[model samples]
Target: MWMNEKIKASEVELTGLNGEDIGIVPTREALAMARKLKVDLVCTSLMSSPPPCRLVAAADAKKEAQAAKAKSSDRVVKVKEIRLTPNIEEHDLDTKKQQAARILQAGNAVMLVVRVQGKEGAAAKVLLEDLVRELKEWGRAKTGIQVSGKQAAVQIDPVA
Candidate 1:
């Protein structure tokens, strides 16, 4: 964003501080107008025949950019994953369920993964069904149990 004396363009399409078009004018005259308004001549577009420049306070532009950055950063959502085995003990299952419930309550998505090995592979489907039933109160399953090799997985999102 070339501004003031740093702008080497001979002519520029100028816009007023209030965003009204001031048409194309010599760079020197634009700089003089910007100085009179107590604002900087910011080069906004360089692709036109004469680069487009706007009269604006640099501080205001920086503040607007910072506000936009903060607003964007606040909307991020996180996905949480919980891993389980087909033979998971009752107490362990309860603990995992609590963790998943907390994640769902916080408006995050949860991925339930059931790992099976050897003989347990045949029971993976049943284990996943029970897990989905137990977690029904917390969230609805977005993806039905999908088994791939040694693992079966389901994705659940918050109820509301």
Candidate 2:
């Protein structure tokens, strides 16, 4: 990204503002040419014998980089977790379902976890299966119900 006087090389393989090859030239001459065009002399590749340089407007490069950053940020996906118990009441389950639906509509994945304690361990698996079936319209299960210690969990992703 060395530009203008910041470039330490004495010579470079230059490309014009319009991307036309200008061949190898002294760094001072390249700087003068860039000055004439009101652009920057940026060192693009330093691996060659004569480092490759390009004449480009600094403002344009900055704008392009900002646009790319914004584009990448917009495509970020988040995973949201909703925890429940096997003996959760009907009203609470409905509330959780609504929250999961909202998260799915916003383009996020959901991890459903049913925490089991003592005698509740066996029934938690059945509860998780029923929960998956209930939410089938909003999302598809990415993983089958799995038991890890005292927790039964499944991951679901929003339907495309």
lDDT of 2 by residue, 41-115 (tens): 888667887999988897975675577678877766688999999999999999998999899888899999999
In the predicted model 1, the residue pairs found to clash are none
TM-score of 2: 0.56
Tens digits of lDDT, candidate 1, 2-111: 66788889999999988899999999999998888788888866788799888889797566557767888775557798999988899998999899989988988899
Q: Which one wins on lDDT?
A: 2
- In model 1, the runs with Cα more than 4 Å from the true position are 1-74
User: In angstroms, how far off is 77's CA in candidate 2?
Assistant: 1.6
Give the runs in model 2 whose Cα sits over 4 Å from its true position: 1-74
